[model samples]
Structures are given as C-alpha cells and as structure tokens.
Target: MMGGRGEGVGCVGGVGGRRVGVRGLGGVFEDKCKEGENEPYRGALAPALALALAPALANTHHHNIIKLSLQGNVGHLVQQHAICHGNLDYKLEDGQGPVLMTTVAMPVFSTKNETRNRGILLGVVGTDVPVSELLKTIPKYKLGIHGYAFAITNNGYILTHPDLRPLYGDGKKRRKPNYSSVDLSEVEWEDKDDTLRNAMVNRKTGTFSMEVKKSVDKGKRVLVLHNDYYYTDIKGTPFSLGVALSRGHGKFFFRGNVTVEEGLHDLEHPDVALADEWTYCNTDEHPEHRYLSQIEAIKLYLSGHEPHLQCDKELIQEVLFDAVVTAPLEAYWTSLVLNKSENSDKGVEIAYLGTRTGLSRINLFVVPDELTNQDFLTAEDKEGVFNADHFPLWYKRAAEQVPGTFVYSLPFNTGSENKSVVLASTAIQLLDERKSPIAAAVGIQMKLEFFQKKFWTASRQCAALDGKCSISCDDENINCYLIDNNGFVLVAEDYTLTGKFFGEAEGAVMSKLLQMGSFKRVTLYDYQALCWVFSESSDSGHTLLDPYFAFFSAVKWILTELVIFLVEFNLYSWWYSDLTAKGYNKGKRRKRMRKEDG
Candidate 1:
C-alpha cells in the first residue's frame, strides 16, 4: 500500500545550469569548416565508404568516444584534449577521483588536399557533463527528508550514470561491480523486478514502488519508486523512460488521477459517523442468552402448518413484532448472534450490512436446534464464501433497495441425517430519533419451515411500502422479471413476468467515448430485481451512455485553445511595439503618409 501524504503539485524543473551551452558546442564542432574555405573536394569515396560502414554512429555525438570509435573498424588515437580545462573538473564531486575523461585526434589522410602531410583534427567537438551534475535531474519532493529522483534506461540500466561507489555500494569494502553501465537483467543473485522490466518492453506509463534489498543499508528496507514515462520521439526504439525516485521519506508519488485512497485520509469530510457505528458493533460486552421458551408461546395462537411445533413459530413472530414497537434496536451496524460451534462453546455468526459509513458484519440470531454447539466455522470454512460465487449473494441483501428476505442455506449440516438448513427472514425498518428510516432489517431466526413462509409475506408488505413490485414462489428455480424502458423484458428467465415494467441492465453498452474530463453522472432505473443467485451475473459489463459529455468536452478544448491564442497574440503585440510611441504612432504615420501622397 502507498503511504498517505497531503495533496501536492510540482513540475520538472528545466534542464538548467548546463555544463556546455548550445553556442559553445556548435562552435567546437564547426571549427574546421570555419578555418578553411570550400575547395574542389575529390575524396568523396572515402567519406562514402566510412558512411556505408558506420551509418548508425557517423556524425552523431555520444557519451563515450572510445566505445563509438571501436564500433566502427576505424583505428583512431584518443587523448584528453582539454578545451574546458578548468570548467570540466570543477563540477566533479570531492575532486579526488580520476579525471575519467578523454578526447580524440583524427588524422585527415586525403587524396586531394595535403596528401603528403598528415593534417589532424584535434577537437572531437562534444559536451561532457560530470556524473555528479547529472544527478540533479532527480528533485527533492518534501522537506525534512532525503528524496532523490533519477532516471534509468528501459532495460534498467542507470543511464544518468551516478557514481557507483556511494549510491549502489557501501564505499568501504563491497564496491558494486561497474553498475554505471550494468543492467539489472544481468544480475543473477538479486531479485530483478519483472514488473519494471515489462513496463519498459510494453512502454507503459504509471508509477510503482518496490523494496531494494541490494542497498548498502542492510536490513533497513529501502523503497524505490519507479515512475514509467512514454517518449513518443523514441517510440519502438531500444529505449524506454523510467524515473526512479529514492523514497527515504515515507512518500510515493502516483503519476495520474487521484486515487480513492489518496483522497481518503486528507478529505475534509471523513464520514466518521458511519465508521464509528461499524467499529462499535465489532466489539461489545455480551453473554449468550436463549428466549426460545418465551418466543414459542405465541406460535400456538397463529394457524399451525406442521403437525407439531406450531406454538414455537408464533412466539418468535410476537417477540420480533413487539420488540420493534417497544424496544429500540439502535442497530446502526450489523447485528450479532452468539452460538456454539463445532470447536468452541461460543462463536459468532456475522451478517454484514453495508451503509454509508462502511460495510459491517453482524449475526443477529441464535437458534437452539439449528446450530447448537458444533464449534463455530473454522477459518477455512469462512474463506470458502468470500469468492465471487458466494459474495454477490451477500451483496444483494446488504445493498437492497427495499425490505426483502432471502432464504439462504448455510453450509453447516443441521438434521439427524445431517442435512443443510436455510434461514427465512422478515425485514423490519430500523428508525432514527426523527422517525426517519435508517435501515430495514429484522432480527428473527427460526428452523420451522411453516413459519419460514411468513418471510415472503413480510417481504411483499415491505416491498409495497417501499414502492417495489415483487413475486415469490415455493419452487426455488422460479425467478422474478422486470421491464425495460422500451417495454422489453429486462431479464429473460424461465419465471413468469407480472410486473408493471421490465429491464435487466441499464442498457446495451455504447462504443462511443467521452471527451477528456467530461462529467458522467450515475443514474438508477427501478425494476423488480430477482433475489436469487441464478438471476444475478458478476461483471455485468458497462451500460450505454449518451455522447453528450464527449461532444461538450471537444467544444471546451477548442474554445480554450482559441482564447489562449488570442491572448498570447495581444501580449506579443504589446511587448513588440515601443511603449512610449504607441499612442502617437498612428498620428505620426498619418502625417508622413499625407506628405508622401502630396
């Protein structure tokens, strides 16, 4: 995870304080042409032959002349022809290292001019900046920290050419084996990041960080920031751009849009109310209590479905109904239920309900026979339901539009034959002090199948109150249908469609793109969404959007550029003309024009 730092904005300071200016470099390269006048040059074949052989290197300036000279089969003597004698060495740090510098003397053996005498061009004509000076490209990001920015070649070579002794090595005994020209690909003993390597090959643009175990600071993990940039001019070449920032201070810079995490900690409104409710519900003081005998009394009054246990289901309903009318279940977060598990005497079953603050897990019921002291679910069992198959089932309930009940069977075995049991729930509205609804949920649990049917009735009542059309069935395979804006079936399934309208997704996805920085608002269309897993699909894909945002963005960009052009033109006119003569220039020009006309 990237560490949090406040929002900031900075730019790459220009490549200023250059060792050799443009004019100086140009003068050195053109000195030979300046000394002599144009002659009838007849040694064109010699120059042509040289070009044919070293076409890639010919007439191009590079970092090392020795490497370049060796590449072309032309044998030439190289020596340090000191031009910027004092200026070159002055830039070196500490000034104790060898003047690791050199120049060249090319003998002009021509067939036309001065054939007998060996006239030599002494100056190689190039700019040489110290390695220490090259390190300036990396800038410090914040105060009270040592943050250095550097650049590497696409192949992970240190192209900026930092002194290997201090940066990569400890400088005492263990010196890095010529890291100045080495690529990470050649290092077998160290961990070569495949991520950084792939970024160069694919020419990606993004920011990433990794720990550098090879650092001289042993055991102290050093975080290195790798910010990839794409260079259009060097596209498809053997080089890619990578800016490596040394993060000694706990700050990492992301290149593009502000992420949710980046905006989270520094946001003025942190949404603490919902967070506090979640945190409180996660921990509390409680002892396991059973009210089965009290709840069973009311069940005998309601019509009996099974041959026995009729009284038990009725009592559970009255207990839930009276609790809402009299007792306040401030239930801002998830409800919790304590139970005995297969391994432990007491364990919690959590049902998570997500609100504005955060998604919370609460299990509100503990049934006697359903799961009495089997040892709570093991860690492996909990992880099984965290995947795409089971998680979406949980999402439908936690982020419901209306009061709904879903009969989902837990993986645990319940009956004497060890059959899996399911829970049917009746959702009740939880209200705030203003009597406004905060959440819709009911804390009722039962094993009786007859009482379970009441959950569907309660669902219909809650749905009507919440303005949702719904249908229920005993056969689990049957599903509900909704209508789209076009009156077409929103989702096509085997279940019968009796709803007012139908639509499944927002609409078919549109291929049209939006202009840069266009505002796209989220919209919701009401439909009877089926509450079963078979009805829902993961990664449903995108929805069709109108081209309005893209159209507007183009107009904004054009207008902005036109305005900028006009403003720049006016500014240039003001700066170019003589300020003192501006007002009187028209009058003076008119008099001069009249005289000329006369």
Candidate 2:
C-alpha cells in the first residue's frame, strides 16, 4: 500500500538552499509546516525539520526528464522549471528506519541573462514517491480470474510480486534489500528455462504459457495447471510489467451447456439495449458488425438435419436476431475492432455474424480481412453474398461443441490473398419461452500481426500514468506467443508461424519447453562454454576473473618462474666446480709420470 504522501503529486523546493519547502494541491506536508516554530520559509510556514542536502546533487543533469515529459503529454507549469530523476532509494524518517522511494525533481534554473544569479544553480521542486505507490495499481489489473501482475527491473530483479518478501536481515538488523534484490526466477518456481526472465529483462513484449503445480486439500492432492503470461517493458524506465493467468480459471473459452445459472447478469440489465430494435442492425451505422449470412451459416441452419429455416428471409432474420441480441458485446467489439495498428492500413480486419441452428452455435466472429485490406470492405456497397466455400472450417468444428463452451481454431487462410488468420469462438445456448435451447456463439478472428501487437500494447500500457516514461515493444529480439495445451502456436509475434506446431518452429520437444526447461539448459551450456573459451584466451578485459584474482594469478606465475630459474642456476654452478677439480688432478698426475721416466 502507498503512503498518503504518494497518493497525490507534490513539489519539494530548496535543493541547494538552507531550507526546503513542500507544496501541492492536496496541501502535502501542511501539518508538518504548521508544527514548525521557526521563521516562515519560502513565504509560507516553515518545515518542521531542516536537513542537509547531499553534495552530489549539485552536478545532476535532467535532459531525460524533458524528453519524458514531452512524450507523456504533460501540461506546462505556471512557472519555468528544469527536470531531474533519481534511482530507487531508502529514506529514513524520525520513527521509521527506512522507507523505499523514487524521487523526481523539477528545478528552476537561473536564466542566462540574469545579472545576479546568472547561469547558477537554483532551487529544485521534487517529489518523494514511495516505491509502493509506483506499483500500487499493478495487482488490480489482471489477465483473468486467477491472473496476477508482477514487475521486475532491467537487471531481472523483482520490483513487486505477489510472493515477494521485502525484508531480509534478521532481528535488529532486519531491513529491506537495496531496491528489491530478489530475482524473478526465485518466485517463478516453475520457470526452469529462464525464458520469461530473460525475455522481460531484454525488454521484449510477448506472451507464453507454462505449467505450475499446486497443492490442494491441505497438501493431500496436487494439481498441475497451465499458466499463461503476458509481458512488456515500460518505455523510458528500467522496469517491465507482466500479467499471468491460470489456465483453469481464465475464461479463454466456455465449455458445456450454457445455463441461466451461469450469470449473464449484464444481459439481464435493463440498460442493455439494441443497436436497432426493429431491424437487428443497421449496416449504415456498423457495416462491419453486420454481415450477410455466410454460406456456412446458411448450410448449417437451412440445410442441416433439422432444417430450421426454409427461405433466405428466415436466414437473414436469424442473422438480424443474433446481431441485436449480441448488442451487449458492442463495447468489447468496438475497442478491439476500431483499434488501428501503427501501420494505419492494418487493424482488426474483419467482424462478422456467423449464425447456425441447434442448441449450440457460434453467433459472431471478429477477424482481420483475409485480403489484409480493411478499406476495401466499405469502399462500395458490396452485395451481402459470402463465398459458399469461404466459411471458416473451424466454424463447423466449433459448432459441434455443447453451448457455453469456447473453441480455439488452428491457423487458416481466408480470402484470395491467402493471408493467415486465427479464430476463437465462444458458444451460448439461448433459451425459448418453454426453456428450449437455441444456439448462440461469439467469435473473433485476428491477423497474427494484429493479435500480437494488441497484446504487446496492452502490456506496455501499464506505464500510462508515469508521464515521464514511455513503453517500447518494437525490438527485433521480441518473440512471444499465445500457445495452446499441446504447444501449438496460437498468436505469435512471428505471424508466419501462427497455427503451426510450436515444436515445428522451435524444433524442440514439448516436454523440453514445459517450463522453459530447454531454454535454461541452453543458457547454462552457453555460459559454461564461454567460460571455458575465455579461460584459455589471454585477453584480460574479457577474462571472467576479477581484478583481485588476476593480480594473484600474476604473482603466482612470477614466483613459479623464479623458483625454476634458481634451481637451474644452482645445478649448473655445481657441475662447473666438479669439472674444474677433475682437470687439475689429471694435470698433476701427468707431471709426476714424466719426472719418474727421466
């Protein structure tokens, strides 16, 4: 939880002055000011206490702050101001030993033309934002019911996580680690491959899934569940935001019978109104939302075993009925459909009504245009005729499921251009007056690129409130995907691989990738190999050893060489002495022999 000081923004004055002042719309630090008995400071009440400013603060540069403020669309202040930012740190209060905070300062610099304080440092306006406040809203935003959010720094250190324990030292020495030292890998026990950690630290935006084991019934039983993760780096900051969802709890799709017991409470609301009460929908207002019955829908509803509708009017009416009934979904559709990509031409390419008869049916589909051209769809008043063969094959597969269940389709081609697309459909069982079931389903189709971008942008949006920073997800190293149970690529940054087997693209077994298992092994192997190669090389800069170890190694080599040289020199001296003695003896013996012969 954030302290009161962090809830609202404030300004701190007098960085280089003898006294500092704090002010804000919320009257920040007003109580402390009132308690002071000293003379008034900054033309207001004096602060309760005076503290010494650090000498290092005098030489700080603030150019990044200006750039961030501009990107964040920050409004101008009444007065001119300069900017400065600080790293995460701990501030010890009178009673509190230490509290972590991030300080950002906006300074008022002396003008170049000023006569008295020309080009000199002036007072600074800063705020102490507790780290808790910086990340307070993260947990509230989740991927699904069992989803959660976590953050990490550029170095892979955990910033905020559900399982994080900030305190480390024991007893009187107990204190928070320097700016969250815990690594993300510590709590993500199932992440064996280090894929999530590496990708996030490297500032890539993507999604992936893993399996997690949980104990239930007081550890009597264990359950293996799939966990999905979406992550992206915050722009202009050293942090990344991630959201994880449990497979069972997240409503990726609905399965089994759609019952009244399963709440559609929003639909029951009186405020839930239709686009057009008389006609199911008006193509003029929402042309993309209303499509003429696809040949697939007509075949299923009109020519199927039950033969529910006899004529084209009946089929068209069914389309209108489905469209009007699904009005509650407009808000969601609008957000997704209207969202355009960085490339203006690309967006949610297609949104259509795919109706079929039975107790279970897929009612609507929002997809990218197969032709990859969204503008062509509305350029002319085209006839409402769909190619008889163009209905998605996945639609039929989805229609086979019981109402209230969700279905995910493999990648397929649409339109003559053969662009690949994926669909996710949810089935709804509509009830008649006597409680008989009529089928209804809502589905969406997205281009691989559009789908990937949508989720990546979602992760980057986490830094929206921090006006001084922006998020970037366009790194070439970015590789993330939405995968299914069997490791099939669903949505991926690499759009070409959409709908392919994950193993096929990655060339690894599913078990190896279970929890980034293979990735971890690869990283370890690379590390060891590099260590071995660099160990044999003579490059001191690239050597793994620290300066201390290098110094000791040099000393050891010199000593070894000195010992060998001394032993060799001693042996040579001994050999020369022995040879000289032998030569003198031989000469004396030859002289004695010559005298005896004379």
> Which one is best on lDDT?
2
After superposition, the stretches of candidate 2 with alpha carbons farther than 4 Å from their true spots are 1-86, 91-98, 104-126, 139-145, 169-173, 176-179, 213-225, 252-598
Q: What is the lDDT of candidate 1?
A: 0.29
What is candidate 1's lDDT per residue for 447-486, written digit by digit as tens? 3232234444554575557675444543366543332222
Top model number, TM-score: 2
Model 2 residue 44 CA deviation in Å:
52
Q: How accurate is candidate 2 locally (lDDT)?
A: 0.43
Deviation in Å, model 2, residue 237 alpha carbon: 2.8
**How many clashes (backbone atoms < 3 Å, residues ≥3 apart in a chain or on different chains) does model 1 have?**
28
Off-target runs (Cα >4 Å) in candidate 1 are 1-95, 98-123, 142-148, 153-156, 161-177, 185-195, 198-240, 245-598
lDDT of each: 0.29, 0.43
Please provide, for model 2 over 82-193, each residue's C-alpha lDDT reduced to its tens digit, 9 standing for 90 to 100.
Answer: 3233344567777645666655555545444553335355555555656544432221211212445666665566656645544432324245433345577765756889
> For every model shown, what is its TM-score relative to the native structure?
0.20, 0.28
Give the least accurate 10-residue stretch of model 2, judged by summed lDDT. 44-53
